[model samples]
Target: MPPAYVEALGSVAAVLTTFCWIPQAVKVIRTRETRAISLTTQVALSVGVVLWLLYGILHVSWPLIGANAVTLVLLIVILAMKLRHG
Candidate 1:
């Protein structure tokens, strides 16, 4: 595959995964209810995202790095809300 095509694929993947948390994050922000959220899930996801970010950095892939960075922040917010409202 061409390099540009590969990069485009990665960017699409990054965009999807990064924005997947938005709905739940918005709900939490509005409702402030996170009792149903799982700490294990959140922690696992955060760790996974961090790992992806690190991998992106190592690979020098800006799309992956940027997507994961934003996702990490959003994940942190959800985790905090879960802790507060659990």
Candidate 2:
């Protein structure tokens, strides 16, 4: 496959994972059932997201920047919910 296709695979993966979190975030918000969610996991995810956002911005990867931004917000919401009710 061409390098372009390989790079596109990365974007596709980003989109799928980033968007997939939407449903989980929505479910968590609605049910407020976050006992199964780990505090450590959310914290680590948030940190990773922020770092990815920074890397995306520095590298001018708009797709990464946008996806990470949305993912970061979702993670923050989940983290806050977990902290509030965990």
Best TM-score among the predictions, by candidate number: 2
| lDDT against true structure, model 2 | 0.92
Worst 10 residues of 2 by lDDT: 19-28
lDDT of each: 0.91, 0.92
lDDT of 2 by residue, 1-86 (tens): 99999989988998898988888889889999999998999999999999999999999989889999999999988898899889
lDDT of 1 at 33: 86
Candidate 1, 59: how far from true, in Å?
1.5
* TM-scores for all predictions: 0.82, 0.87
lDDT score for residue 35 of model 2: 97
lDDT of model 1 at position 46: 96
C-alpha root-mean-square deviation, each candidate: 2.2, 1.4
TM-score of 2: 0.87
Candidate 1 runs further than 4 Å off: 1-10
lDDT tens digits, residues 1-86, model 1?
99999988977887888888899889999999888888999999999999999999999988879899999999998998898888
